[model samples]
Target: MEFAFNEEQLMIQDSAARFLAQVSDSQAVRTAMARPEGYDPALWQRIGEELYWPALMIPERFGGLGLGFVELAILLEQSGRHLLCAPLFATTCLATPALLLASNPAVQDQWLDAIASGATATLAFAGTPGLEADNVQAVAEPTGNGYRLNGQYLQVIDGAQAQLLIVAARSPGSQGDTGISLFAVPADSPGITRHTLPTLDQTRRLARIELNDVIAGSAQLLTDAGQAWPLLRDVLLIAAIGLAAEQTGGAQQTLDLTLAYIGERHQFGRAIASFQAIKHRCADLMQQLECARSAAWYAACVAQERLDPTGDVGVASELLEAAATAQIHASEAFFTCAAESIQLHGGVGFTWEYDPHLYFKRARASEQLLGSPALHRERLAAQLLGETL
Candidate 1:
């Protein structure tokens, strides 16, 4: 199927590109990364209040612009291109989607307006590092009309500053997917503690959250035990698509920066871009970017198309496969292009003063943000084998 951005979408993309280019310069990003919050509050307010970005995808009923995921993806792509040090990804790509997929109207009504009004939220999942079923370590026990959660959840994106946290934890007395549930815990809860983690990609902040008998009221519980699988899967699939779009944009920016650098940096009395090897590397990057863009954009279109109240089962499966494909291709393409960009720029590229290494760090970290290529390949294999392993 043909894939191209519409006029409105193109306008949105251009505006984001311009805005990020102005506010998210390499130095600005570095300065922000050095901060405890890892982002500028003033810049974030401009994005939320002026640009109305956080509300871009929420429905109109929730005081949002009523746009689709495509719009959200475009903004994220621009942010990624600039290596922006903001909590936009956690709020838009992760927390919002988790709420939407939960299939609970009350919860949606409660949070969507606040998110649209510039309140920040983040997702807390990934109990451990592995992709296996056994990786889930957090457990929640039923308490007085609610659940008391106890576990150590690592590396929650923007956990330190977020006002709300959309958490995924397993309930007592079950194994595998059945006992898992979703919760919406206030960040300042009594028993929840957070510690910022040192990371390779300083632009993105990650925090380790410890829940010591943390109380989750009934209102906080989004999905009951065993009923969260489908919703969680849907949220993940959408997140993958958004992340893939980001990766594609980051890859494209890296390629563009390299192309410009090669044309300006002379060797043997001629621009280094004149060399056949450099030309070949540029061509490979171009191909990877095109492929990644197509994968990301196509998946975005499919995700936007499936936003109706009644979704086709076949179409939903297609969306899942497309998301996995986008994640795999875009993640790898960005990493490859970043590596090549560093090589094209010679020794200076590896230094902290240079900008290429920042993109490189982001690329490496993005590879496993939601899931790794190997994990996505397993999903692809299951799709082909027609079995869930």
Candidate 2:
């Protein structure tokens, strides 16, 4: 399949790149990340209102641009390049899908509108240090006309500022896969508490939530307990693709920055880039980045095509495979590229004052988000073998 971006998509990508480069300057990102909030609400509003980022993922009926995930992925790639400090990915990509896939129209209308209008939301998944998919442990109990949730959910991205939470909780007495139900709980619900967690990547915020008898009304359940699996899986899969795209962009930038630095910095009366070792390393990064971009773009294309209501089962498999491939390649490439970029810059790269470490921190933290390479590979292998383990 030809995977080159079309003119419109390229334009969007360029615009996003330019916008993020202007808004998320290195010093600004550093200052925002160093703050207790770990992000800039003003910057968020600027992107959401001026750039219409939050509305990009929502359907037209919800007062959004109704663009496909591929476009959003392009924007996110730019976001990663600048390490934009906003909850755009969590709210627009993760929580929006859960709300859109839920069975409650009223809930969807309310949350979707809010999200499309720049209101932030988050997905609360319970996991340990270096969390992966299938690490969730939150539980729900069926009550009269509602469900009572009690559990500790960790690493909720942007949880401290999320107005709504799209939660996946195991329901008591629910049999089989149906036992897992998704909920749209308002962040201010009684008995719900949030504690911000310290993180290496100060640009992205995380929180731990404690819920005690947190009542989820009937309107809160987005999908039937049994039917939420497919939707949740789809959401997570797309999220993986989105994150992979971001990592790919970040990797590309690191490569560019390092090569530029090497080209300008004179060593032994000549530019260091003239060295064979540096040239070979840059070539290696180029290959890795190309492979990552192909996977990410292909995944985005498949995801966009799958939006058609009549798409075949192969669409699902392709989406899974593409996302898995992108995540694995991009994660490794970003890490390698980050390390290489620092090495290429010599001692100056190691200092906190340098911008290279910021990308390094982001690359490290983002590698484990959503799911890890090991986890995604296992899932891909299972799917490829026609199993669901």
Candidate 3:
């Protein structure tokens, strides 16, 4: 099979990179991150109109460009490079999949359209780090012509900006996984509260959402009570792929910035780039990035296929490998490249005002968004041992 990107993929990457360079410049990202909501409405609209990155994840019948996840991965890579602070990741990568995976056609029509059109959204899954399985602290009870939801979801990315939320809650009095259900909650619903929390990544926002006796209509259920596992699994796989792509992009940017800085900065009356130590270090970084890019490409290819049962097993295995390995290598590369870039730039890299620090912070933060290096490694070991983690 061919590993190279087709012309269309190259064009998408070029367009995304150019757009980020022009609109998501360091100053622009800093300004946006400083805002109360931590996103730029104007820039968000510009990209939505020009590139349709948000719509790229949706299917054609649902008013989308239907370019599949690979193209979206390319766009995310550019976003990572620029540290573009926006709700696109939450809306496109997280919410779009959740809506598509939901079994209810009516609910899909309502939310997927808005999500594809760039209307912001966030998803609340119960299996996030520190959240326990078999934990039914949150529940949904059938109410008059609707349902009442009471629960809390933490570490919700861009929750404050999300106009809609996809919440995973269990039904009261049901046993096993049979009681679990997915619900679409409007952000403005009464008894729903969102509290923004400070995080390591300034470019991305987080929120703790609480819902107490908030009534939701039957029309809001994404799937029949229980049986949402199939859809939820797909959503998680897509999320893992997107996160891997972003991490790869950040690694690439870190390496490029470090190389450029070393080439210009001099030490002992010679360019630092000319030194053997710098040359070897840069080569190693390049190797790590190329490996990550390969893994990302393979995972993206898997996502493009319809994610069938046989394909799912293969893709899941490959995706788990790619995501975990890419994250580990990218994390190491970013940290090393960022530090080396700083040293090459001398005192300038150490300053808060420098752009390298921004990439450094983003690389560190993106590392943990969809599970961590250690987590993936553990999963990998389980897979090798003929057991699922």
Candidate 4:
């Protein structure tokens, strides 16, 4: 099968790279990260209007551009390279996919429309890492006409800017994932509170969210009780593919930056890039970055095919393997490239004023955002062995 990007996808990738390069420089990202909202509203609005990146994957019937996830992945790569501090990922990659997988008609006409039309959203899926599999940290109780939710999500990306809060909460009496469901909570809902939390990657903000008896109408429910995990699994696959794409982009940027630095830095009246050892290191990083790009792109292709892992064992295994492979490779490549780039830059790379550390911090933070490389490898191994994860 052909693996190269189509003409349109290539155009999207090139245009996104150019747009981000022109507008989202390091200074712009720094300014946005320092803001309370964690992004420049004007820039976000302009991209939504001009590029429709947020609506790329939403269906045309739902007021979207009707593009595929590959297009979205292309844009995400550029976002990672520029460290664009925005709610784009929270809205497009996370919330949009959650709604799409929800398959609720009412949700489509209401919340999805707003999101496709450029509203911001943040998804609270699973509690912080290290929770027991049997543990359900958040719950929603049926209240006749609606539901009452009580729970705390310690980490939410861009919670402050999200106009919609998509929460994954379990039914009070249900066990494990069976009792879980998806709900779209208005950000201003009463009994709900959000506080920004400092993150290792300043470009991607985080927040702590608490809900105590937050009331929700039946119309607000996105998934039937106990049937949301399958949908969530699909969403996770898509997210992994998209994040892999972003990580590939970050790795590429790190390599490019390091090469430029080494070429310009002279030692003993000769450019360091000409040294054999430095060239070998750069070549190794380049190989990693290229492999990551291939893996990420292949995963995106699988996601675009709309494979249903739950329907067929072969499909499930393939999808899981593809996502795990892409995520593990991309995560390792980006972090390795970031770390080596810094070390290669010598003393200047460690300082706050220098930009490599910013990328290094992003690498370290993203390595754990979804699941670490080791975690992904463990899951992949379980699948390959035909054992439970």
Candidate 5:
């Protein structure tokens, strides 16, 4: 489908770019990442209150701007470009989608407002590295009052700092997607332990969470017992699209950084960018960035359509394929551009004083965050072959 940003989208994009350029510069990013929280609280508050970015896609009834996925993608792209150290991705892309997809309005009414008003949240769904049904190993046993959860979640985005934790678990003895459930547990609840994990990408923080007989009352249940896989699956697809947009932005920035370096660096009394080899390399990076950006934009459009009930629902079926395609392309593009950026910058790229290494680390980390390119390809293949995932 033909896709282009409208006037409003362009305005949002420009505004995000300008704001991030000022508040999320290289020095600001370095400062934020050095902190235990991984972001400045004041900056996060400004993002929610002044920018209203966290509420961009939430429904107006929920005290949000009631925008769509495209707008969110635009904002995320700018965030990725600036390496914004915030929980926006965890709050908006991961947890918010799960809350929005849940069938329970009570759950939505309880949490959506909090999220819109700046309460951070994250989804702790993967007990393992892969994004598959079998990865949900957390077990939830029914109690007279609510439920008792016992399990561990690894690599939860912003898990250490989020105010709310949307956890995915399954009934005892249940396997695969059946008997899956989601619970909205307070991060400070009893018997819950969170530890921030050391990561190569210091720009983003991930945590390991332990839930030991944690209580989740009935009101905290986000989905019907044993019937949350579909909702979780859709939420993951939307998140993949959002992440793909970020990767595309990172790729563009890496390419731009490389170009600037090559143009200014002198080699044999001439700019390195004037060389045929460097020109070809830059051209290839541009090609990859453009392709990745195109895939992300298309996926964003498809996602927006799927979310709109009055839109052509037929396009909704393509969401899975679009998400996988976008994820695959964007992941590869970002990694390639980041690696190339390092190489193009000579020795400084490998130094801590330079910015290329930071982007490189983020590229490698994000490629495995949601799912690897190989995993996405496998899912895409299974989807095309009509095989169960």
Candidate 6:
């Protein structure tokens, strides 16, 4: 596989970096985080209409840019570096993949077009941090004309403000992957309630959503009953690859921030950056960041191949391995680098005015957003042992 970015990909990366550096600076992030919606609506509109980032991975038939996952990864890395405060991750990475992988063509046309036109959406699958099949606890019962859904979803990214919600539920008494179903429902549908949760990372919003006898028509179902697990599983693998890229970017940014601070900080009539111990620590951080970046980029490449229509069927297993590896390595690298950045910055690192604390919170929060590093390691081990996940 080609590991280097082509000219077009390089241009996308450069444009994303420059745009985010100007719009999502430290003060802008703080201001957006202080809002009830957790982001600036005007800025989000500009991102969708002007930059068209949400349409990067959607097909051209759906009124999108018809780009691939690699482009999305590039944009995500830049967003993560700037600590961007928007629903782009939830909408593009989580919801868009689910829609693309669903079996219903009509549902795909409707939602994909909306998303490409700046409509934000998110997936509500797991009630907890893990994305295992059993994590879906919502119950869906078939009525005369549709399905009645009743359950609660926790830690849904951008759930409170999303215009649409792609929900996962299962038939009564269903366990594991059996009887699973996915529904694309409007966020304001009757009998639905959503509220933002207090979290360590304010830049990215998470919410608790409840469905009290919510109704979904047959047209709203993304897949037939008991057939959504396979689709959701693949969608989650894609989401994992995207998130790994973001974590890699955050790790790189933390290293860069620490290096800049150390260079300016002097003690005993000399800069602390000249010290051997400091140099060694920075070197270790760089090594970790490089490894994480490699893993993330490799996963992104595998994801693009997996999504290709003409690609080999055997690429599925490779995609799984790549995603798990990237998730494990990137999560650890980000958290470790964020912690080390705090310690290296001296007394002001933990202060409210310092940027290290924000990165630290984002690192800890994102580490558990999909699943912990330990969880990914376990999954990878199982897959390597010839066990079905």
Per-prediction CA RMSD (Å): 1.5, 1.9, 2.5, 2.1, 1.1, 1.1
TM-score of 6: 0.98
All models: lDDT? 0.85, 0.83, 0.76, 0.83, 0.92, 0.92
Candidate 3's C-alpha lDDT? 0.76
Candidate with better lDDT, 2 vs 6: 6
Q: Model 5, poorest ten-residue lDDT window?
A: 308-317
TM-score of each: 0.96, 0.95, 0.92, 0.95, 0.98, 0.98
Over 4 Å off, model 1? 131-134
lDDT of 6 by residue, 256-303 (tens): 999999999999999999999999999998988888899999999888
Model 3 lDDT, residue 189, Cα: 88
| Per-residue lDDT of 85 in model 1 | 85
Query: Alpha carbon lDDT of residue 279, candidate 2?
Result: 91
Question: Which residue pairs clash within candidate 5?
Answer: none
Better of 2 and 3 by TM-score: 2
Tens digits of lDDT, candidate 5, 1-389:
77888999999999999999899988999999999899999999999999899899889899989999899999999899889999999999889888877878988998888988999999998888778889998999999998899999999999999999999999999998899999998899999999999999999999999999998887888888889998788888899999999999899899999999999999899999999999999899899889999999999988888777568857756988999999999999999999999999998889988898889999999999988899899989998999977
Candidate 2: where is the Cα deviation over 4 Å?
A: 127-134, 173-176, 308-314
User: Candidates 2 and 5: which is better by TM-score?
Assistant: 5
- Please list the residue runs of candidate 4 whose C-alpha ends up more than 4 Å from where it truly belongs after superposition: 130-135, 307-317
* Model 6 lDDT at residue 234: 82
Give per-residue CA lDDT, model 4, range 203-287, as digits (tens).
Answer: 8888888889999887787887667777777666777788898888888898889988998999999999999999899989988
Q: In angstroms, how far off is 224's CA in candidate 1?
A: 3.7
Angstrom error of the Cα, residue 231, model 2: value is 1.6
Model 6: lDDT of residue 242: 96
| lDDT, residue 247, candidate 5 | 91
Q: What clash pairs does model 6 have? A: none
